[model samples]
Target chain A: SAVISQKPSRDICQRGTSLTIQCQVDSQVTMMFWYRQQPGQSLTLIATANQGSEATYESGFVIDKFPISRPNLTFSTLTVSNMSPEDSSIYLCSVARDGTYEQYFGPGTRLTVT
Target chain B: QQPVQSPQAVILREGEDAVINCSSSKALYSVHWYRQKHGEAPVFLMILLKGGEQKGHDKISASFNEKKQQSSLYLTASQLSYSGTYFCGTETPGGSNYKLTFGKGTLLTVNP
Candidate 1:
C-alpha cells in the first residue's frame, strides 16, 4: 500500500475562483487518477493522470473544467477551473502500483464553493 | 459504465451476517471492493479477477461471477467497526486497465 496525501484538506472558495489540489505519494507509482464525490453521491472518475501526457477524462468531464497534470510518478495535481457552486465536491487522488490490483487513495480535498 | 450495487442501505447486529451485491451491464475484467468510513477515503478491501474466484479476509469474504457480471461481498459475524459505506469498482477490458468505474456505495451500519 502507498501512503498518499492531498493538500488543502478542506477549503471554502468563492464562485468563479479556481483551486488546484495536489496529491503526493510516498513512493513511485505507475498509475494515478483523480476522482470526485459530490454530496451524498458515488465516486466519479474525473480523469486518469498520465505521466508526461494529457489526462484521459471521462464523459461529462472536460479538461477545461478539471485540468490535471502528472509531472512525475509520485506527484500529480488537479485544478478545478472556473468553479461554481455545483463544482463543490471532495476531490480524491489514487495511485496504483505495478503488478498490483489495488489502488490506494489520498485523504481527499473537500472543496466548498460559496 | 458504472456498476450497480444492491441493498442501498442495510443494518446488521453484532454476530449477524450481511451480503452486498454489485452488478454491471458490460463484461468486467475485475471487481474491487472498498469500505469508507464517514468523511474518510475508501479503503481497499479486496479484488476479484475475471476467472470467477472467491477471496476473503478474516470474516469478510467476496465472490465474483464473471458469467453473471456480478460480485457479492459477505460479512459474517459483523462487528461494530464494520459500519461504513461499501463501494465496488469495476474494470473492463479494451481501455486503461487501471481505470475503475465505481458503484453507488452500499451503506452498512452494524449495531450492538
Candidate 2:
C-alpha cells in the first residue's frame, strides 16, 4: 500500500469554470490513476497517468474534459474543464503498489459544481 | 462491461456472516475487492488473480471461480467497522492492470 494525498480536499466551483486536483504519492510509483465517484455510484476510471507519456483515458472520458498531467512518478494532476452540475463528484487518485496487485487511494477531492 | 453484484443491500448484526457475490458476463483475468465507508475513499481488501491462490485476512476471505467468471466475498463475524459499500472490480483477459470494470456496489450494513 502507498500513502497518497490529494490537494484541495473539497471545492465548490461554478458550472462553466474548471478545477484542478493534484495527487502526490509517498514515493515513486509506476501506475497512477484518476477516478470519479458520483453520488450513490461506483467509481469510474478517468485515465491512467504514466510518468513520461500522455495519459490513456477510458471511453466516454476525453482529454479535453479531464486533462491529466503526470510530470513525474510521484505527482500528477487532473483538471475538470468547463465543469457542469453533472461534474459534482468525489475525485480520487489511486496508485498501484510498485509490485503488488493492491492499490492505494488518496483521501480524495470532493468537487461540487453549482 | 460492468460486472453484476447481488443483494444490492444487506444488513447484518455483529457476529453474523454475510456473503457478497460478483459475476461477470465475460471471462476475467482477476477480481479485486474494495470497501468504502461513507465520506472516505475506497480501500483495497484483496485481489484474486486467475490461476492463483484464494486470499483472506483474519475474518474476511474471498474465492474466484475463473470458469464461471465469478467471485464471492465472505465476511465472518461481522463487526461494525465492516459497515460500508463493497465493490468488485473485474479485469478481463488482456485488460490493463489497475484498469478495472467495477460492479455496482453492494451496500453492507453491519449493526452493533
Measured by DockQ, the strongest candidate is: 1
Give the alpha carbon lDDT tens digit for every residue of B1-112 in model 1: 8899999999999999999999999999999999999989999999998658999999999999999999999999999999999999999988844689999999999999
Which ten contiguous residues of candidate 1 chain B have the minimum total lDDT? B92-101
Q: What lDDT tens digits, residue by residue, belong to model 1 across residues A1-114?
A: 999999999999999999999999999887899999985679999888868677899999998998888989999999999889999899999987778759899989999999
Model 2 over residues B44-104: C-alpha lDDT tens digits?
A: 9999996545889989999999988899999999999999999999888875545787898
DockQ-based CAPRI category assigned to the predicted complex of candidate 2? high
> lDDT (0-100) at residue B108 of candidate 1?
97
- Which portions of model 1 show Cα errors greater than 4 Å? none
lDDT of 2 by residue, A15-110 (tens): 999999999998999889899998678999899997887899998999999999999999999999999999999999999876665778999999
What's the TM-score of chain A alone for every prediction?
A: 0.96, 0.96
> What TM-score does model 2 achieve against the real structure?
0.96
Quote each prediction's TM-score.
0.97, 0.96
Reference-based lDDT, residue B86, model 1: 97
Candidate 2 clashing pairs, residues 3+ apart or interchain: none
